[model samples]
Target chain A: MQTLHNGKLTRSVSLEDRGWSLGEALFETLLVQQGNPVWLEEHLARLARGCERLQFDFPERALRDDIHQLLSESRDDRAVLRLCLSGDSLGVRGYGAVSRTPHRYCQLAALAPPVRQYWDEGIRAFVAKTRLPEQVELAGIKHSNRLPHVLARAERKARDFPEGLMLSASGLVVEGIASNCFIAVNGELKTPLLDRAGVEGIVRQKVIEVLRTQGVTISEARLTLSDIEAADELFFCNSLIGLWPARQLDCLSFSSFSLCQRVQKELESVWYV
Target chain B: MQTLHNGKLTRSVSLEDRGWSLGEALFETLLVQQGNPVWLEEHLARLARGCERLQFDFPERALRDDIHQLLSESRDDRAVLRLCLSGDSLGVRGYGAVSRTPHRYCQLAALAPPVRQYWDEGIRAFVAKTRLPEQVELAGIKHSNRLPHVLARAERKARDFPEGLMLSASGLVVEGIASNCFIAVNGELKTPLLDRAGVEGIVRQKVIEVLRTQGVTISEARLTLSDIEAADELFFCNSLIGLWPARQLDCLSFSSFSLCQRVQKELESVWYV
Candidate 1:
């Protein structure tokens, strides 16, 4: 696949790059529909915040130029864009040497077929054993140190589940493998507070915004497995697939999704662009 | 600095590499003295176990060949070698696609001058606000997702402390920025139990084995700041810097180090080799 590395057309970076060695980086995955990113500014805002947390300067101009240069020549909808930024190298094993010079690597690829299928038919999710650590230092940012997600996603695939849910190390349900989880509890949407862990997904914010605009209440609550068990409806949302209404969580099948359907409908307007 | 990429001489890897994008990798830092790596097999064993936890196939042959190719022609007594291995590129943003094809990058550089100084003059330590997340999934393995260490180290630097001590989110002291901590209490050495967080360092294992062989007691225990405050002596140990007897922690001064000196002397024979 063709890639834009620091606004240049190449697929190679320095082997000493911090992203490779230390994971001193953050990334944002977005959906590009008809040559335009659906929520470009919102994703950038989150990315900028991550850069701030990591003491990295956002390479905004270079990144935007790369996006524009690529999109100007293509009109493909359902394309996935992954923008990664980090402060260059680890400075030769000096843990204190956090570079301020940012490196931007962006790739545009076709959205995987399973994403569309999962979005349509919902997905079967099992709670994974890989627990998210309570690291407020890296919370709410889509940083690149994603071994927990990788392990959890693998666990789900091993069990033949399309998606997996993860809990904090203390066992509070936090999020899905790649999405923010939302539950309709007593007709109000409640998601786990991301004060301690989990990525604060932009699509989750969009869902909350759309629902709130429609006078539907949504709040962040410390959720557990029992809270999920007693929920009237369940769903997952992310930037790429937009929303996946849960049809089955373990053995407790979700045969009905009135709120989930409404969420998908509301998201379709912006997701489809 | 000379570099080896997958047993060949090169200084670049694919930008698509999972090590760059997702930090799906593990690395070991060793002191190469007089054409031989200190504790090569021991470090490899720890790396292999980490590979197992990450569901990675340790690329033993390629890595061994790379080390042999790189080290054969050099006889630098005080050199630093960083060996990195990762299953290659994230396959097209498919989180489920875990590539088993390993990418090995090795860098051999002259040991930085500060290492020797730090080894001589004991360092001042500070309690870091960046707590280690209590995720047992990642505990004990030196995987590349090191944002916690990065942040804590930065915090320590900002406060002008040479080394930083991190606690678990639940307020239990875990480990140092790059070292495993040991404290002496009533003539026995105790370290923080790493079941919840922190990297189980190689030198830490070596120190324990040496101290045990010397008939000195060393055990893992859940440590707190109060425990550190009450310690008779304090020290840090890692692969590169064998041991640093801490002189001050926050504002607490440590003047006597009977147990610390004994442990350091036991490790010196092995470390100075």
Candidate 2:
């Protein structure tokens, strides 16, 4: 495994050594094809927004160089790359110390590509009891505070399901445990609005954009389980998986995956940049 | 710096190395005095509950032994010890992998005691714009998803304040940036209910317990900024800082620290266990 830190390659780097708790960091996982990243600018833009929201100074140029170096040195035609930006130490200084200087240590690592079966035949998902809180301040930012997703994934596994559907605190169907969800109802695409909860997934926006460009109106509205049950098709999308049609959600089976397949085809056409 | 991993001494351990993200971890900080940990059982109980909620197999005996080892090898009569339990990776198996064997990489580190001046003289606090989301599943658990606190602390620093009061998503006063909050109103002690938001701090519980034992009434209810502004006294309590009286919250001043002082004195009588 090759790792790049602040534009430099290094094998020995400790994220925990500098009090860089994962929750205090922001990260973006991207799929690379032919030594190039899909939607690199959009991912970095979201990272910068997360840094601003969490008060970390985003070293944009350095991180871009790091990504460039990682891509240039890597030979994997298809793989997963994770760019992690860890911030300053939240020491015992909260006692009386008034301030802290934010530090940036960006690390990028390449990992195995996501499984292909999920995108091929779709996946089974269950509604999780774990809900995303309605913290508007941190909502939509992909900071590393992902306990809700972790618990939701655990809940899905406990129920013997493949993936899980996360709900907002208000019980609205928000997104998948790690992927954004979209459903077709009355021939219109509908996905949950992430203003109150869930990450503003890069692939989700790309899907919406491609659909709109093809003259398909997509509604970014609050979606409920009942809404999903009546939907014509269902699918999950992420930067890594691209798109996985939800073959079954609990007892509700969504076998009509034509729309999902079209979207996935469009996604793959450009996802491997 | 000495590091203890799962009750054994280790000089090197990377939390991210094993795919363990900090948000998937649970931690509790305690003040150690003469080799004894303050609120040992309480902290462990909270950690266990957090483990249960996050699906981590709580290695109770090993953790207890780790605390013992860390405290024994340390020479500081008065110091702070942090017990961190980070769990296994949420592997890229976001596709279909159903289960994961829980890993227990508990790290214990000795940190410097909190600065004393904030405790002696009340610290200044400002209400933070960053609100705690109402995620009932993770409301009171000290899971490491603490980006809200980090951002709130930075907001406080930018505003030139020592501490910040966090409000819930519904505009209710929840707690301090790192501590639980309490206020006096008409000779009664009032604090926010942790069932919906905020951490269930050990020191805050101790304060309530001691005050109730002394026949002082304490109410754990929802509080708002208006309620705080009309209060007689305000204070913050945490396991690390014990308690720090709030001299000023924005423009409202609290000069009478009698109740806060009484609670502080009672807290000190047993906090150095």
Candidate 3:
């Protein structure tokens, strides 16, 4: 529960006074490893990009310096550092809130390895009755307005499913609740184009880059339930989980040996191995 | 900026410590009139409903009593009161934030009001390029996750229009960014049925109730862009701005004397008269 604003500790401030009520805040959650944040620069860059999108003035150097200082003081090798940028009439600046009890804030109870574990074996997914709004302006940026995802997550949670696929009102497949979706169709990696909606996840971007370097052809295209059902393999990707294979969806199940192994190995090389 | 937790003032609390971050918080915003909040009971009822939706424990009696006590200390007759509910292992309770400088917080700038004034006269609104996700579980409730509206608002703002109309990907018109939409077509008043992907706004509900009492025939139907384009009149409604007429959208414009007079009279009877 340690709080710092502009690299200085503050106490007993009103959340609104601190500008939380104005919805004038942008936040970054970075994974801390070996007492240092992994991909720190990338996270900062994304934070800067988010600030630009919101027209919030970003204090980049100050934030970077503060993180460096805080990491230097911390003893834990792995933790999560949350950087919140609250907008002020003066400008946007960074504040830090760290988990005093790391386990409660950073560690989540591991689920039954997700239904995707059975994807290589066979997993079942269904088109969630949910629809996503097509909003181009906020399409690729991740901001605090996440009620739709929250709703979607609740539905998925209630159904006891690892992930739920969302469709736009137009019946175009968008992405999973918390991950970007991809399908290996006829030996090519295809994901839904995010020009209209969905967050442009950093992990998804990195995975795409890695896949490209490995000579895998990837394309962003409009996908539908039919397209997914016709694919050889289906998977979802996120920073924390890397890759999850989908086996069964609704009543259609696809089991592909080569495609699943290739993606699993590729993600392992980038995340674990 | 004064804050109260369960009617008691406190400083520096964490979502984890208070369990507020667990998504258990329910909030309500009421317009204060001469230091008294307008339709306070209605806002409280909405908050109660939100709590029920989230299955959080709420002490309604205590909260209402506290609000009454706090209102007595108000200096301005007209202000805004925000009530937030949080929970912990202990139980669920409420928090209040009252505006001290009510005038400063209450003034509305004439900054390009959403769409052009001509649209205010009566305009045609097309379905936005983006669609809303239909999640029945979270469809009509107002919770903290508001990213969908944020995206919609940004999209509308980018279009440089007073407002953008959103449709559920299923082709049903839902709502505007921060307002509810209604249409008068073929001698009948129609609005989107909110059983799927829109909020049940207090203002909207109030307007509908008043209209019903006046023996005006209003029906909740799944509407489409074509239906709107063919309508004789269109307007957006919200609590802050009672009813705003749309004059021109995209290329269509309608100036219906009967419709405009009816809406004006409705507002006059509700507020001005």
Candidate 4:
């Protein structure tokens, strides 16, 4: 594993030698292909944004160089690189790398192809009985406090559903466990604005950008269950899977929508591997 | 650095490895004293509860034995032990020691204390403008998904306040960052129950038990900012620092009441210092 701290590579023998033990770190996961990371700038931007939200210094230029160097040296055509910034007596900064492989447990068991199939066809989703606590200060940035996602995902898995939708305590729809939910209403695409909750997923941003360029009006607004249920089409988006069309939601299904197919085709044409 | 898996100690190097990169782990932090972890049962219960919440297997016996052995050999009279459980190919358990010392940092050079003498004499507090998201499943467990606390604490620190009084998105007061809040209202002490959106802190539980045994009536209820502002006394409690008296909050200040002093003395008398 290649590790970096404050923009310099180190042969540290112990994870403890870094300030990460204090849980003062933020990270990013990137997809590297052919010894080059895809969407490298976007991933780095998100990482820097996370650091900004956490009030930590981000060495963007140094990080870019390090990521480029590591990707150049890695032999695997496809791999996953993780960048972590940890805080200690010195300050907040740390990074690490990993060659992507299907592990028997987390990477494999925790993530199944059946789950990914939601990206191809669509998914049946249900609103979680639980509501996300509303903290405006923490609404959008992803900072590793993921118990809510874990719990919500467990609930969804128990119900035998592909994905679970969550709502803020104020009764406004937020997003999914690991993806952002979007709906097409009156020919315009709308998703829950992350002004209050949910992560500003990289894929979601890309989709919005792609759609905007296609003359498709996209908006961020507070959505409710009723809105989702009445929409012309529904889908979820995240960095890894790009986009997943929603086939059904608690007693409601929209598998036959032409718009869903159109949007899926358009997104996949650009994003699908 | 004592480690155990499935309740037995083996020289298996796999057990000592950190597999957190795969994201299949849950952990708990507990205070240990004089060869015995304080509230040991409660901590384990929470860990098991978190595992249940996340649908992960809880290695109860092994975890307990590991803690038991570590505390027995430690030289420090008090220490913080962190137990991590990960679902990986190698195995799913690990233990590590955490620093007892608190690390304090400032955003723009720590602002002057919000209320002078509150550090020593305690201070009154007001409900923050922010509200915690309502995720009932994750409401009361201490999980690694602590981004909320980190964000809340940052906001609180930026405001030059020692604490941020959080409310649920539904406008119900919850608790503070890393602390449980309580107030003496209408001649009776009351705290917000942890059924919905806060950690069921071991220290909070112990204080409630102690107060109940002393014939001091304590009720777990939804407390409003009005209730707190109107209360005859206010204080915050946690495991690390027994109880801190609040002196001033926003525009309100209450004289140091004798009830707070009496409770402080009673608590200090039995505190594990």
Top-scoring candidate (DockQ): 1
Candidate 4: TM-score? 0.77
Off by over 4 Å in 2: A7-22, A90-117, A158-160, A269-273, B7-22, B90-117, B158-160, B270-273
Q: Show where candidate 4 strays beyond 4 Å.
A: A1-25, A89-120, A156-162, A260-273, B1-29, B84-120, B123-130, B155-164
Regions more than 4 Å wrong, model 3: A1-3, A10-14, A17-26, A86-131, A156-162, A246-273, B10-13, B17-26, B34-36, B52-59, B85-137, B145-177, B181-188, B222-236, B243-273
Write the residue-wise lDDT of candidate 2 on B96-196 in tens digits: 22333344444434555654677778888898888888878887888777777776766656335767899988888889988899998877899999888
lDDT of 3 by residue, B163-245 (tens): 67788757789987666888887767888999878878777777677677766789999898888889987777765445767
- Error in Å for residue A202 of model 2: 1.8
C-alpha DockQ for predicted model 2: 0.43
- Residue A132 lDDT, candidate 1, scale 0-100: 87
Candidate 4, chain A: TM-score against the reference:
0.78
TM-score of decoy 1: 0.95
Model 1 interface RMSD over true interface Cα atoms: 1.8
* The candidate that achieves the highest TM-score relative to the unseen native structure: 1
* Sort order, TM-score high to low: 1, 2, 4, 3
Clashing pairs in 1: none
lDDT of 1 by residue, B1-273 (tens): 678887778868766577777778888998887778889998889889888887778888888888888888676777878888776655556566457666788878877433555556677889889888888888898888888888887775633677888899999989988888999888888998999898888888877887788888888999898999899888888777778888889899876667667666766755576
Worst 10 residues of 3 chain A by lDDT: A96-105
Proportion of true inter-chain contacts also present in candidate 1: 0.86
lDDT of 4 at B134: 67
